[model samples]
Target: MIGNKAVYAGWKAAGMPDMLNGDDHFAYIVGYSDKTVHPQNGITRVAVATIFFRLLTDKVRDANSTLTNNYSDISRGIWYDHAVSTLSKMGIVKGDSHGRFGPNAPITCAEAMTLIDRVLNRLPESRDDLLNGMIQWSDNTDTSKWYYLVVQEAANSHYDDIKSDHHEKWTKLRDTRDWTQVEK
Candidate 1:
């Protein structure tokens, strides 16, 4: 499990869109009521969903917040309801065969990679494209896993294009965006 500080630093380094403004500080990863972030502990599925949703541009969040999903375990009007629903509507998330989204479960590496790839619209053209000396996984020989390709693509791909495209598309929207509109 990575720390919240590390995640924030990585997000900044990746050039991902943010909602912060001068004298207005915000954090996607909030601490518990006790004021401890528990950075070493594994993050839950619901927490990951909320973090990803918070990372989106305000325009995108408003446009997709009303979307719905059929995850039996998720109750409407909960804290993570909108995040899960919007991500599901955008095809960034999917439930299991029993239609259950284990919100309390710890997010797996494969699930995280899949979510990130889907958000960035990254799809490798060929297996060879992911093996150009960029990926250096210890278990590279384990090709039978369902998330093998996505993990490889994430490790090999660069986020410069994604960062540029997001900035270009949302610059105008960001100038007049309102964070108060969304339910935190």
Candidate 2:
């Protein structure tokens, strides 16, 4: 959660509630969870939907708001109804062919990248541009992944330097035996 910590701190510094530290309302308000359920294990489809809604609106939640969802798995009165409905109306999100939003399903990297691009107000670059910017990844070539453009744009926006710095730090830490449990 290192990536999110800075954002959390910034939110707190901006006079917003420090909701990132186990605040159930944060998840519920954003439709990432139903208050009773938690998404701490990972990002989920519902969380993506919630983030989309939040990026587009200031009023994140309303107890009196009711939104009809087309997803077969999402019924009326669900905690995510408002956020999901807003995203649906904006065409920012879609359900599976089976008409399921899969609220509890873990979000894929491509999905996360797409959402982040949208949040950043990034329009899709041409396929040619994406192809031209392709870079090699440890496991796969950038173009092989569906999120190639999103990732490439992220790198172009300076994430590559940040990633390299982190890699160097991790390598140094590994050599020093200060940490060995690093995953990849």
Choose the strongest candidate by lDDT.
1
Q: For each predicted model, how many residue pairs clash, with residues at least 3 apart or on different chains? A: 0, 0
Least well predicted 10-residue stretch by lDDT in candidate 2: 167-176
Q: C-alpha displacement of 104 in model 2, angstroms?
A: 0.3
Stretches of candidate 1 off by over 4 Å are 1-25, 125-144, 157-184
State in Å the error of residue 131, model 2: 6.4
Candidate 1: residue 138 lDDT (0-100): 85
Query: In model 2, where do residues sit more than 4 Å from their true spots?
Result: 1-40, 59-66, 131-134, 138-145, 158-184
What's the CA RMSD for each of the models? 10.2, 10.0
Per residue, candidate 1 scores C-alpha lDDT tens digits across 49-121 of 8887877777677877764789999998887899999988877788888999999998887788777766656
Candidate 2 per-residue C-alpha lDDT over 7-84 given as tens digits, one digit per residue, 9 for 90 to 100: 110112343322122223333343324554453567679776876565443333342234877888877778677878
lDDT of 2 at 23: 29
Model 1 TM-score on a 0 to 1 scale: 0.65
